[model samples]
Target: MKTYLAHGTRFEDTALCRFLNDYGHADLDALHASAREEPTRFWAEVEDAVGLTWHRRYHTVCDLSHGPEWPRWFVGGELDLFENLVGRRARATPEQPALIWEGDDGDLRRFSWRELDDAARRLTTALARLGVCPGERIAMYLPMVPETAVVFLAAARLGAIVLPLFSGYGADAVASRLIDSEAMVMVCADGYLRRGKRVDMLGEARSAAAAAPALAHLLVVPRLGTPWAPQASGQWREWDYRSLVAACDPDTGPTIHGTATPLMILYTSGTTGRPKGVVHTHAGFPLKAAQDLLMAFDLNPGDRLAWITDMGWMMGPWLVFGGLLRGATLVFFEGTPDHPTPDRIWQLVGRHRLTHLGLSPTLARLLMAAGDAGLPQPGQLDSLRVFGSTGEPWNDAPWHWLFESVGQGRCPIINYSGGTEIGGGILGCFPGLAQKPCGFAGPIPGMQADVVDAEGTSLLDQDGDEVGELVLRAPWPGMAHGFWRDAARYLDTYWSRFPGLWVHGDWARVDADGHWFIQGRSDDTLKIAGKRVGPAEYESALVAHPLVAEAVAIGVPHPVKGEVATCFVTLADPAAADSADWHAHETALIAHVAGLLGKPLAPARVHRVSALPRTRNGKILRRLVRAVWLGADPGDLGSLENPSALDALRDYRDSLEAVV
Candidate 1:
């Protein structure tokens, strides 16, 4: 593997170094060991370092008497996350930029810390007047706009649990989450621009509100400036967002709550049933996000941070709370990265002078296919100091392009890996660490992560090459409290597999250099000819080919090998698919993969398509692809970004069956 070293500053100049010095630790490894040995003391120091204010101090840092599965953090403390992220920041730095939004058509909106606080306060008053109380769920189904951030802040201030739905969701998808959470108020938009087209969000919101009986009020933001009125629906009432805020007072203070009080209920999709609501508390998610940003990513006050994401994704809230808590300016874009032109993302980075940028490996692969002509010229991305990656494991080509080409070999690519239930990240690359391409330095401090085999034995202690399940031996602040109203399901999902460990369903390995790499989801692992392999291994090999833009490898049932790898790919050039020699090209691609990995590990077949099924966050849904290929019922596709891709796959399967 190749390693990249940061060329900008010495290790002593980083925030991680300063934190280590303050904690009387010599290096990153030492701090991590100390954090594992003394979690309570480490977390107390972290709270102080991040400047988390408590209205009423806690008597204990953590209470794990209930075991690691249901540990309580910050017992007896009282503080509103809104107060720490916005109210205090507004009082301290009133004129500093808190949020910056850019529309698809190049419109701009900026809000200072004080301005954001006032806006959120007014909205909070409006919600209270509408009879929204603490513990009541408030659903937000809006695009990535200034109002989206305001809704999150207002809900937090009003002590209402936030339920964020994806902006691209259809009426049915939106209704499912609303019904599950029983949200009383839903905030949406009139419409939004995507790829120079208008998306009718109001129609979907109205349909969803009617379907969900629990929804009472619908607040709509005029994103496209369309004049609209409330429809005559006895099921719910509608209010213009701006008018409601104008009619309310901004003096209503934040509602205080205990540390473990529920702040948000984020729903994540499963393979076969309804989406599971991952519960996060007041002091859990925010503290972990801030710690990761401050200590791992080296994000500092006044530095601009931008992650291409939707308001519904975890990174969306992660960016808002974490960036604000760290006093960093956040840049939110209202459209896709490659809109109108391929250089749009690079242009945004240049325009906002973003210091820290986060994106998915799929998005990186998309941009990489655009070539250097579509990228920024010299000095365009000079302001960038660090790059963050998550959502999915990365292939070498795209990872290298992001590091060497975009970052100019100066910034370190912080490969962060974690799920919604984990709050932030289990593993990440710190600033002072030498990073290999597409590899993490190790587990985040205090995570107590290890790679274990089926019987829960450490794989790191064994010899030769080995991969095993990523497990956590202890609890951290960011672990989800439990699935909403489904404690049994939560326990069965994470803890049932291992007696006392939180089994994160990812296949991971630690290299000889002590670098960690996540292969792929454990459930997605393929067993072929008595050997287990990760789908990423085949997809990475296929993507390494010059013609392949994106790839997904799935295991299909086979009589001989029990399962065989079937690959689906999109071409870098769409015109290539229309060529008369397309079959020959596919054959050559299969040969390429067979040469890369030995013949036994090669894919059985390669199919070309225009696009692949992905979520709004740009993670390819391999299970959905496999289901569509096998003619199985694809369960819970609410989070899928492009449903049309599934239709294309179905058509290919139909064609193959007809030939048979």
Candidate 2:
């Protein structure tokens, strides 16, 4: 029998139910169909339902005359994201909790709606005093502090685009983005506490600011009471964060702009080449994020939503906009989840009473490896209503463990899959549907997505067993305004492959039960002999064994089979894997994989490692693995959290090459 964390009765009382009731939709399927069939009407209703207050309403929902590649949404509309996120909400409920932040050293801080609005107003005034004009770019290189949120919204209030850099980025990675966007100002912190250690960020900001000639101002927030000595550069000026706030008055006035005006320029990790600035407009990203949160995650007023993310990643901005737009309280944690103790996250849930919590599958596996002994008591997690996931594809083992252990089989795992450019979820599990362990309910509303053949001539719906490239037939509001200053690259990357369709690089298929499963990135597919297989399939089979913590499968050169599979895995116990009897365990694991996937698809070799190389956001760098194995130049190491793990992988690769 299939296990269900939430039943139909549980979903009937959700925020999605209330929204559908007001709109007179019978169920989620009807709402999804309505959104796909008549997107304009659906979006118009959504604007009103979500209480979007615009200076001037849009004439049309979207203009797709130029095709999906160049979609213009909310045409002729003018509004301020700050007004929607802070101004209106503050005016209505000044004392309501807007943001709750917890520091690494066990310090807690909170901001009510009015308090956050005042912070944004003061910051905006200070920015304007610094000659920050509309359409300029301001870079933010800071920790997940409350001030970070203020800086983001203040930049929007001034009609300036904010470029959020990852907190972990070094000088080169930081300077590349600042130079690319021609950022005028940078807001940074002196340092931040992580894992009981202080990490200095001001030095990196200074180095980046020195290289970025466009930078004219450096605003430093002193988190550790450290004095900053700015380089005596004639081209730029330095100011203290507290001093600026104290010297300026709150600017409570509204700043409006055209609907398509750029609000943010978030740079991709430069996985393929130079980092492309993915531009997002006010109405574009905010509306799509709000809609996805409402319909997919069942967000609403009074709900507390928390996700483990950084401002540099899309989820950071997504949650910031989605939570406030939906009138839900947002929770921001400034440290690692399992820093001081394995129960830290659980304690936060019990303390803040977060109803919706989101994390990546890698994070969940890490916690699972830590074991459930330190977890909260059963009733301690009573406030949690939904468990959300994103980043990468989930294996059945970790997904089941998270569902059973964390949720107690009473909360739904709302699996969301999308990209930085999409703004929100492309495929998501709705609260109104019965969810599988690792399957999405369907594509999000208003997203006309399907699994189509390579040529895009026909849909691959062969009894739900056909796997093909995922593509979107129609344009949605959340789609990026194209890569900044690189329209040709944007078209070539997404639109050129399938004519008019937006070719998402993921290989996906819809099962007979209407559940969608993303196999992996199409570019990362492996060919063994004559059969093609996704890395996820092989990894999933390996992770089914109790000894394996995580696994990554790659196609290595084979003498006779043309190409064969090899898996690098992290065991549950590294010491045990290093013992003399390790060969027996490895043979047992290989046999287990062969039993699951057959000998033809079984990995020819399996190696044990202490850890896998992953990005800060928990995404495995598969390309980097292949590159290290083949001794090729790995494109970018900016997003890597543990670069040292690559050294261990290289040693393993050298051993394999010895046999070859």
Candidate 3:
């Protein structure tokens, strides 16, 4: 395996190195082992290192009386996330930039620490006047703008739970979360600019408010500068966000609550069931996010951080809470990455002089496919010190392109992998460690992570070629307390697979050098002729062919082989679809995969397509791809970014059936 050695100078001054020196540890591996063996002591150190403010001290760092599946953290402590993230920072560094926003139309806005806190105070007073009390859920469906941050801080200050909904969601998707959470208030925008066009969000928010009987108020931000009035009906009322804030006095103080109090109910949609609301607390999610930022990513105060994400995604809250708690300036973009121009993202990085930037592998693929002209010019990304990746497994070509072309081989790609339920990363690459292409250094501290087979036996000590399920032996502070109001489902989803083990449904493997790599979702694993193979393996092979830009491999039922791989791919040069040699291109791609693996494991079919179904965060829905191909129900598509892509897949399926 190819490896990228970390520069010794780079590790000399990183946060991880400083931590190791302070604790008298020689390296990260030693600290990790110590953390796993004594989690309570490790977490206490982390809490103090991250500088989390507490109104009342906790007696215990972690309480496991309810078992690992339902562990309580920071027991008996009283704190408020708003106070730590905003109020404290404002008091200490009032002149520092706290938040910066850019609109698709080239409009820019910046807020200092003091200014952000003052705005949050006004909004908190407004929410109080609306009768929003502690524990009440406030659903935010607004775009990535300054108001989104204000609303989050405002709700958090009042001890109210914040539910961030995707700005791209339709009325039905918005209403489902509102009704499920029984949210008393919904915040949205009048409209926002995307691709230089205005998207009317108020209409959808209004429709959702009407559908949710429990919703009592609709607070709208005038993002488009268009005249709008509230259309009140029954107990539900609409109010202008600016007007409401202006009418109230600033609520200068924060409402303190128990450390384990629910600060957010982040709902993650499943393949076949209702969206699972993952509960995160004031001390739980924020602390984990800050810890990861400080230790894993080496984020520091005054550093500018930006991630291409929507407010509804976990990274959105992760960025807001973690960046602020670390005293970093946040950069929010109110449109797609490629909007207005292909180099829009690179322009943002250069314009803001961002120190750390996070993006998905899919986005990297998209940008890489755009070729040399589409990438940053010389000296454009000189300010970038580190690159962060998550959301999906990375292919070698894109990963290499990002590492070599974009970063110029100077920075490390901090590959982070975990789920919404994990609150943060289970495994991540540290700035202080050597990295391999598409590989993780190992589990984050406090996460007792291991690779196991069907019997729940460790695979790390076995052959280096084996791939197995990723499981956590002990609970970490960042784990979801439980699914909101769905205790049975939560237990069954993660805990039922192995006794006392948290089965994180992803296939993983470790190389000879102890570098970890995630294949793909274990549920998406394909069994061909009794041989278990990850879709990433096949997808990786297909994309290696020069013609293919992106690919998704899924298992198709076969009477003979039990299951066979069927592939769908989008070409690097889209115009190649209409070429007369398209059939030859597909045949060559099939042979390439067979050459990489064996003939027996080769794909049964390869179809060229324009796009695949993906979530807002760029995770390709392989289950939906297989389901649509089989004319099966593509369940729970609320988070789907492009429904039209599914329609294209369905049309291709119908054409195949007609030909048969």
Q: What would the per-residue lDDT of candidate 1 be over residues 174-286, giving only the tens digit for each residue?
A: 99899999999999999999888988999999989989999999999999999888888888999999998999889555578888888899888767777899999889999
Clashing pairs in 3: none
C-alpha local distance difference test of each model: 0.89, 0.85, 0.88
Better candidate number, 2 or 3, judged by TM-score = 3
lDDT of 3 by residue, 1-660 (tens): 878854422787888788778767778878887897877878898898888878899999888898889888889999877888888878888988999999988899999999999999999999988899989999999889998889888888888999999898899889989998999999899989988899999999988888999999998899999998789589698898888888888896557889878889998876676789999888888889999998889999989999988888889999998888888999998877777777888999999999899988888888888777568877778888889988888999998988888887877899999988998899999885788898898888888899998999999888665889999999887788788889999999999989999999999998888889898999889998678898999988988888898999999999878899999999888886675887887788888999998998889899998899898667788889988998888878878989999999999889889999
- What's the C-alpha lDDT at position 233 in model 2? 78
Clashing residue pairs for model 1: none
Per-model TM-score versus the true fold: 0.98, 0.97, 0.98
Quote the positional error of residue 440 for candidate 3 in Å.
0.7
Off by over 4 Å in 2: 1-9, 457-460, 658-660
| Per-candidate RMSD, Å | 1.3, 1.7, 1.3
Q: Write the per-residue lDDT of candidate 2 for residues 83-109, one digit (tens) a residue.
A: 888888899999999999998888998
What shift in Å separates residue 261 of candidate 2 from its native position after superposition? 0.9
